[model samples]
Structures are given as C-alpha cells and as structure tokens.
Target: MIELSEVMLEMKDIIKDFPGVRALDHVNLKAYKGEVLALVGENGAGKSTLMKVLSGVHPASTHEGEIYIKGERKKFANTKEAESAGVAIIHQELNLIPGMSVAENIFLDRQYTNGPSINWGKLYNETEKVLARLNIYDIEPTDLIKDLTVGKQQMIEIAKALSLNAEILVLDEPTSALTDSEVDELFRVINELKEQGVCMVFISHKMEEIEQIADRVAVLRDGKSIGDITKIEDITLDGIITRMVGDEVDEMFPKEKFERGEKTLEVRDLEVDHPLREGEKKVKGVSFEAYKGEILGIAGLMGSGRTELVSGIFGAYPDDTHGEVYIRGDKVEINSPEEAVEHGIGLIPEDRKEIGLLLTRNVVDNVSAASLSKFSTMGVMNEQEERKNTREYVDQLSIKTPSIDANVATLSGGNQQKVVIGKWLTTDPDILILDEPTRGIDVGAKVEIHRLMNKLVEQGVTVIMISSELPEVLGMSDRVLVMCEGEAVATLDRAEATKEKVMEYASGNF
Candidate 1:
C-alpha cells in the first residue's frame, strides 16, 4: 500500500542563479504522496525556476540543491534522467507535436515496436485504455493533435505524462487555457491521480482554483520562500496575495470611468462564414459601435464566436468573412491585417505567444514589427528610428527587461504580454481590440494594463476588449456586449450589467 503521509519528493536549500539575477535563493519545497501542493508567486518570483531545477532543466551542478525521492538522494543530469526517475512537467505552453496523432504523442520516444517497427494496433489499444482510465471518452487515439481544441490538447499532455508512469507531476498553469467545463474535468482527473497516490505540484494564478484543488499552499516572493507550507483552510486569498506580492493590493479590479466622445469605430451587419464548414456562418450579423474615450467589453462563454467576431473585423479571416467595418464613419476595405492597420485598427491577440510576439526575436524587433513604416525611408528600415521608437514604447508601457535587445522568450509571461501591447501601441492606432488581454498575467500587471486602457481612453482612443473574466469586464467597460453561440445577444450599460445577468445572457438562459 502507498503511504500518503510519506514525502514523495523533497528539495533542500536550492539556489539557482541566471546571468545577473539570482532566480531562486535557498528555496525549499516538498510534495507528499496523494496531495496537491499549490505554488503561488508573482511573475519572476522563482516558482518556475525552482520547478525547472527539480526537473533537471538546470541540472544539479548548475544549481546548489539536494533532491530526495522516496528517502534516497538523487542527482539528475538531464530532463531524460529526471523523467526516468518519475518526474514529469506539463508546461504552460503545451509540448505536443501538432501533426502527430494523440496516441503517438502519448507514447512518443517509447513506442510499442515489433522488430524495431511500431505496432499500430497495440499502440491504439493501449492509448484507448489510458483514455478510459482518465474517463476521457471524446478524444480518439488516432486524431491528430492539431485538430483538437486547446482543452483536448491539454488532456493529451496529461495522458502523455501518465504514459511516463510519472510519480511526481508538475503542472505549470495547466488550466490557463481551459474553459469552465474543461477546468472542472481537469480537476476531476487531478483528484483521480491523487487517489492513485500521485504527488502533484500545481502552480497557478487563479486563487479560486488553488483553494478548490490544493491541499497545501506555498508562497514565494523575490526569489525566496516567504513562508512555510500551510494548509489551504488556514490561508485566505488576501494572505496569499500579500505573501506573493509583499504588499497590500486593496482591489483586484480597479475601474476609472471617463466621459464618452464621438463614435470612433462602427461595425454593421458583420457576418463570417466558417472557414472549414461550407455555408455555415460563425458570426451572425454582429453589429456594435465604439466611441472615443470609452472601453467596450465583449463577454461570452467558450465557443461563442467572440474571438471570431473580433478577428473578422480585424481582417484576420477575410476569406470567410463579410462585414462593413467603419473607422471614424469612413467605410474601409480591410481584407488583410495590413489594410486594417492602414485604417488605424490594432489588435492584441488572445494567444500572445502564438500570434502576438515573435518568440525568438528581441524585444526591439517585436515592438517595432507593426509600425515599421514609421521607421522606413525609401523602402529601407532606418535602424536608428526603429530603436528610438522601440525605446519610447518600452518606457511608456513599463516593459521589464534587461535591455530593449533582450530576447522575448527570456521574459516572464506578464512582461511578454506587455511587449505585445507595446507592439500595438507603436502602431498608433485610433482603435484597439484586446482579446483576453489579462489571461495569464499577474494581478499587478492586470491592474497596470487596466490603468493603461483608461489612459488610452483619456487620450481619445477607442478600446474594445473581450474577456471571460467577469470582474474585469464589469470594472473596465462602459458597456458590455454579451455573445452566445454566434450572435450578440445582449448589450448592457455599465450601470445595469451584473455578473449573474451577463452570465445568463452568455449561457443562453434568456
């Protein structure tokens, strides 16, 4: 029988330092069998650094640390060695190969082979059994991962970890990409894993999810452990936030209203057909208007076409869209993002890593990507102007980086998001569309972005935001547009909108 009280994994006096920065300083953490340990921290607070050290991404010699598994001290030279010792990390950015089948990704490196060739039938059968064990019936073993939704892709990631026979699972912000129902399903699977004596480490920014799923909570701040591990019931959300940030944040959502101006953008009879499905429309006659000096919010559940509607207007899906988009009452033809930008429209996409920033490029390149025309003379980019423009926006947006030339991949999630925003701001668009702008960022950054939105409105720029976070929608927008299925079902003024009411409209309750 598995001993639930026994510590499955332990880290002692771990110290990891990067160039010019000590990322983790004497951090200690432990995970017991059958318990979910929640790790909480601000961006760059060393939570991920500590986990990377344990997973051998930093190796033992690179960091000062002692790792014990099952009461035996062990040293891992690489990620493969750590995995062989039963440690698996499911990262925030999924590590699945999109073109491969779900079954292939699950048994990736270790295939069921016959004479050094894969046995397809046995692979499919084993994959089906793993899916059955997880009570996931919707996904087929042979379906390509690219065809699956983000939620299903995450499940495939979990299944891959299980295939490794991982005794210690490190889930880094697993539900950041999931819908409400998907989140519930993931929680159920985590519970099942706990019952099977799997020691799990969960890192998340959502306080409610931490309270719901974590058995114990540990807080990290400024590369140091702020306090010892404590039971979930003993710590409040305020307590956790205080320890994570080392400051009192009185309100999570701060709203500042401003006077409205003339209409800056107007969309009429906007319709978009499904790209893959013929004669099927994803957005149906969606009409809305945004004025200068006001933030308009779009609220909807998953698969409600909120993103499609915005993308279509931004000319991201011109091949399958039909819409009358007007900027400052002048009808515009925006068949591509270039045309949209020429018409003074900017979009901060929902998936920042995928669509917003060039991950391998430096911060200067990303911030100046959209507005290269401003720095070009006679069809050649002026390096001086480009660097000057990038520096200006970096300062304006408060982007944290060692220098403007740092690779975007090295920055934390929040800082990456700020760079994306700065990229759009450099375009000098009169209108901006932000989809899930604050999805994975920390609370401090969220507030900063909210304040920036207000500042933009004050500067006479119209803002349209789509978010699943209800508090953000209510607190930031002057008006809320509720979408369901493929249409705009309700538009409520800020004074009239409530969480329950918007949810009812979003869920088709009314």
Candidate 2:
C-alpha cells in the first residue's frame, strides 16, 4: 500500500521516439520523498531516455508524458527550467571543469555575489559546510577539480546539486568509478539525503548496490515499462533481471574454456614514464605474456598503472616510455598508435567518454574511425564504401540503433561500448587489449561482451583484459596477472586465481 500523494515526482504514460526507434513507449515511474527508486533495464531499454525526459533534456513536446512534481503538473522546456523546479541530474560521465577549483564548480553560473562582485569568502565557507555535511574533510575549497580523484569529483557533483537546492536528484551509474570504501561513503550520504526527504532516482547495474540502497524498483525492457513498480523485498536478482531482459539470464558471465596456444604478445622490462610528472614512472619493469586463444586478465587497484602498461604496449603512451614488446616472437618498435595498429595491436581505452567515441558523430563514423583508410579514395572519404563497412559491423556487433546515422550520444552505455569494440575490430588486430570494457554497462551487455570475447578467441584473436571487477577477471580469464604499485606482482592460472589470491597479490600481500 503506497500513497501517491506522498510522491515527489510522477511520470505517467511517457512516449519518446527518435527517427526510426521508439526510445520509450508508455513508461510510468514514480519517486516518493525520502526514498531511492532504482531504475533497472537492459541496454537500449529506455531508462536513460526516461530520465532525460524528467530532467528536461528531452522537453515535454519531444516526449509524450505528464510530469507531476509534488502533485502539480508542470512542463520544462530545458534543463534550466528543470533546475528551477528543484531537479538536478548527474550523468554517468561527470560534468566538471578541470581547471576550476572545487568551490567554483559547485557554485558555477550562480556564484554568491554582492553588487556585481563574486563573494569568494561566502563561497568557500558554503563549500566547506557542504563537504562537512558529506563527512569529507580532505578536499579543500581551492583544490582544482582535475587534482581530485574520481570519487571526490563525484562528491563535488553531489555538492553542486545540493547547492542548486535540488529536491529530486537523478544519478546515472554513480558508483561505476568508486572503490569499495568510497561506495560505502556514498551510500551513507545517500541515506542522509533520504532522511532529509530528497527523492532520488538511482540507476545502476550492480545488484548488491540496488539491494542496499533502493526502496522500490522499476524495470524497463526494449523501450517500454515491463510491469508495475515493486519493492526490493518482493524480487530476487534473477527476477529483476528477467523483467529487464525479458528472459532468464542463467549465467552473467558465459565464459568458455579454450586451450592456450603459442605466446602471441610478450612484454619484458616495460617502463612507462608519467606523462605529466617529470622523472616519475607510471609503470616500472612490468613483464607478462598473453597467449593466443586465451584471455589474460590484468587485476589491480585503481591507479596501479595497469592501463599505462597496456597503453604502452599499444603505443598510446608517449615516446619517452621505455618498453620491450614482442609480437609472435619478433620485437617491434611501436612509437605511435598507428605503428601498433600496423603491428596487429588494438587497445580499448579505460575512459571511454574521453578516448573511445566521437559523441557528436554517428554510430557509422565511430565504428569506421579506426579503419577509414579502407573507405578513403585519394584522401577523400567514399561515402558508399564507408556505409557498406559500417553496415557490416552494425550487423556483426548487433548494435541497436535507429540507423547508423543516429548520434552515438543517443545510445545507452552498453551499446556505446559495443561501438567501441566494433571500431577496434575494424582494425583486424591479432592482439586486442580491453581496459574496463564492461565498466559502466548493464549486466546483460556485460555478458554479451564476454561472449564476444570468447568468440574472438575462437577466431584466434589474443585478448588481454584489465578489470577492477574481481568476479569478471576470475570468470573470464584463463590466467590473471596481478599488478600492485606499477609492477606485476604475481601471475596465477585460472584454477589458482581465487578472489583472495588475486586481492592478496593486487594489494601487495606477497
């Protein structure tokens, strides 16, 4: 017995369409004051679309719906209007100016002022108060946004929302970048906000988080609401997943064992210098071998240089890096990413939003970005050839989009990741390196990516994966390479790589 009068936000019969696709079809959602409503869905399941509608990123006219806030119907033409109505959204990709200080970002565009002058003292004081409220003490008001860690940046985003006096907060995949302890701290803050009667719509793929934080859950599937909202107590993980995916996901990671072949990629005495800091080494003398027909997992705590090591091998690092890399028993000098591509190497970067896709471009452009030479004639792109190539990958990767011309920004996180993979596959690399391939994607897409990796191995593409999720590493890899403090500490076979063992090595227990 829930009461609708107590609801802080209500969306009824929402319908949104984009070109040839119906992104949301008659979706209904509600969020009560002092409660966290979890949104669960598969890739392209309309969860993001629904949130965009609520935030006014997709205005009322673009989406068919009735939006009620505090029992009063209202229409927002833009995000500013939504903010004026006490709504704020923090996207999966953070929105913070790197050069600005923490306090400046928190009070951006609405800085405290006195007669045409910014009130610096008041801003710092208010920023400190907000930090204290969140139990964060290390971050200074003057600290640059770029200097803080991802977790701290997320806190700043929350603080910014609070500064705007947001009563209804929408968080999309907030915990994807946080560590275990940071996640606990964030959960504490969320609980505090709940007590303050701030309605929150939490979107995440992590089941444990949903169970711990959400008061109610809504499931979306294929651009439609699957059913009515339900309590967390009434559903199991499988049950929620079934509703979101419209089928039973018997196994989250469908890994198949394959016999290891001859060594394909071997790195010895690898050292990557820090790009920004002089005389600082990000990766130091790291050595490992990835065999063909197998997935070699790189396990590490964040900032342990796992990404740097792989980037060095893929020639994404600067020329100052010192490394010895061999492919199929032949040493190669990879001074640039182009050279790496020429030597049958491909890398999917860790920060997908920054390094992976062209947000303004279409799916076809992003998928064919890595192999544009094939579609070029006399230094000019051949549109017909480009479309043919893009269509091939669009079908092969099962990318769900209205058309290849649709902007990549319109797709969900999972589908965006698939586009990244498709871009790399176009290069036809023998050795593929994936850094956090499934970081922010949904569980269904995670399994699909894992299956795709296995399929690639069957086709003899060597796969080296770096992952923070211990379960994924243990479940998908034939061997795990544990890195700690910029060095490879231990290499264990799949049979020997338990979570405890991997964590021990990753944490420098040995």
Candidate 3:
C-alpha cells in the first residue's frame, strides 16, 4: 500500500558532524505521503541530528545531505525556509514565551496587521481557527502560555505546527510530556492528518507508542542506520530494541530488593500553596514515609501535584509550604535548600535542564556544584580535587562523555541525567527524591538508572521517585503511592499495584 503512494519525503546519505563528533553517518530515510515513519534510537545515536538536518535547524550548508520533498530536492537556509518548503518541527522542549498570549505565541512573527498597527481581534480569531482545526476547545487564545498546564502547552505546540500546513512534519518526543487522554487526542489528530495525505516522522523512545501509532519504523545506532525501513507489523518490540542497542537487551527494570531499614524521612500534613492563584494549593495534605532501603514510587497523571509534594518536602518552596518533616525521628528546621542539604536531603527535579544542570558548564563543574565545599578551602577553588571527584563518579555511574570537561549540553539525554544524579550523589544525602528520573531516556539508560536506584537503596539511602509511566512504577517500586489531583488516594504494595488498579486510583474513580 505504501509503495503505491507517493514518496512525500526522502533523505540520502545524511552526514551531520559537530566538532569532532559525527552525529549522523550516511543515514537514509524515506516516507510515504500518508504514512507515519517512526524514528527509534538510543540517545546520542543521531536521531535528533538527522532531524535537524531535515528541519533546516542545521541548515543546508551545515551537513552533507540531499533532502527531497515530493521528488524535488530542496536546500533550506533556515527554519523559515524549511517552513516555506512545507517542513515543520515540534521540538521536545516547547518553544513558547511564558508572558505572551497563546494567540501571540502561535503567530508571533507573522501577525495579521491592519495597515501599520496590529489587529488584536484578528490575531485571536486566527488562533481560534487553528485551535478549532486541532479540536482543542479548552484553551482560549487570550490565555497566557505560563498559566496553562504542561500538557496544554504541548497541545498548543502541536496546534502551532499544524497551523503552518506542513506537508512533512517532524514530531520529536511529542508525547513525552502528554497525558494518556492527550496522547489519544494526538493519535486521533495524526490519523486524520494521514487521511489528508500529510507525511509524519515520529521520534520517540517509547516502543509501545511506536507500535501503536507508526506505520513503519527505522532504527538508528551509533550515528548510522541499522537496517532498512521496515513495516511496523513485521517486527517485535524486542527486535526493534535489539537493533537500537546493537545487542540482545536483558531485563528492562533490573529491580533488586534490599532489607528495609528504619524510617529515614517522613512527611505529615504537607501542603504547598499555588504561587499564582490565591487560596489554591498545588499539593494538599499529603503524608508519606520513606525507609532506608527501598524505592518509593509516586504515580499520578500530569498536574497531580506529585512534584509539588516532593519539592515542598525538599524545602524548595519552604516559605509558601506548610509541612512537618522528620529525619530519623528528629524534627529538624528546614526552611531552604541549604537547610535541606544540611538535613541530608537531595532532590533531582523533573525538568533537568531548567532546574538540575548548568548546561553551559562541563560535567566536572555540574558534579561538584552541590558539594563545592568539599573541593574548596576558605572560599578558594580546587580544580584538581573537583576533577578527581567528578572522575570517580563518571567511572562509578558509567557516564559517557568525551572527557570530564565535556559541555553538559553536548551530552545525550541519558548522560545528562546521569550527570544530574552524580551531582546529587556528591552531596551524600540520606534521602533522595527523584521526580521523573528516567523520563526521556531510552530503555537501556532507564535500566541503568533503575539499577543505580537499587545500588543507592542497598547503600542505606531512602529513594522517593515520581513517574508518569505506570509500568516503571509497578516494575521498580517497592510500594506505589497513587495521587489524584493533589491528594494521595492509595498506597499499594508491590504485589497490589497493577496497571488497571493504579489507573483507577489515579483517575479519581476509586
């Protein structure tokens, strides 16, 4: 069937290089006009690089490749040129201004003008048309971008992309931040687009999604195409993963048990007030306990206040939070992150780039950031000691980098997360709260992070994790705490937490 359709997009020998690294090596791709081509690969395997070349983010002269649209070759100078060529990309990280209205953000550069002055009414009306095209009625065009939930912002990103009327659309980790209901809506829109003869290239690490939504899959490894484009029905999940990692993959979770120790941290009647809305709370009266040798997974849908609860306990918003925390039966005063670190608490935030890493710096600097005192004397710095300490973690955590001095921005998603973990590990905390620790990384990297959690637990660290992925919570958590809205609806033991049961509690049906 695909063979009968026209080739909407094609790439031949795409070679993308950055400094000394060759991100893409003679990679080739082909997609039919109405079909979805799934691009699956491990982090650092050149998926993003190849997409950049195609989307004109890298530009025509930056890479060695021939990109053809509808059997006609194109040379794009910038993103606008690519858009003119009917190419648009929705990046994993949303490109939206928090202060602007949705209408302004959607048609930012190309606003509808009435002679010299801008016509605000026309802008809002055009934005409404775009939202209506996506069947997104909940969001108003006048709404500020920051007021929306992440899921809604993500939907707005899709609406903005679709408004371009792209003939060849690239969705990079589009569903990573989306909820299940939003995902279903997105799939429905995608199917509608397929019927309209719009070609799509989907890049995701979630295999189940690829199997569900993709017509064909193309695997990449070490900056090269592993095999030819194959129909999604012709391959198993295991087969695709094998092509990705270049070997037979083992147990996905790699969960190991350890003896439960004393209660290391306890939260009683914790609440975090909304920063923007008066009398509204992001986290309600939530209570939980974490022991010395177990992974406590918090499961909930997006906007369920899971992150707020952990951040409140970590003293991230101590001024606006009301909570009672006990560390090993000792009531301590923790009104700031410094005090939390002094009380032996470390939190890995859900958004690593925004809150975790110093992207402009190197691995050594990021690893030594939280524990600078250890490598400093009398307000002076010790670069050697910092590098030595970072090297130890690089080896211990198996972090992949060109060197200790490699820029944090240059590393892959998995390695960036490892760097964040290594940063917290230097603090030597008794309690570690990881919010979406393995969010966007591949299956291989996820297993490594899970094993690292087990290692931390065995070493007498109390681990608290929040994951949107239900399978990860069920597979790796010793106990699952289900949250609905801002309340803890249920806390089930490992044996009691099934996918359906957890969803029931999370959906507020139980």
**Can you give the TM-score per candidate against the true fold?**
0.93, 0.91, 0.93
Return whichever of 1 and 2 wins on lDDT.
1
lDDT of 2 by residue, 37-79 (tens): 9998886788888888998999888888899998889899999
In candidate 2, stretches whose alpha carbon ends up further than 4 angstroms from where it belongs are 1-5, 360-364, 372-387, 405-409
lDDT for each residue of candidate 3 in 427-447, tens digit (9 for 90 to 100): 999999999999999877888
Pairs clashing in candidate 1? none
Q: What is the lDDT, from 0 to 100, of the residue 213 in candidate 2?
A: 93
For model 2, which pairs clash?
none
Report the poorest 10 consecutive residues by lDDT, candidate 1. Answer: 1-10
TM-score of 2: 0.91
Q: How high is the CA lDDT of each candidate model? A: 0.90, 0.89, 0.90
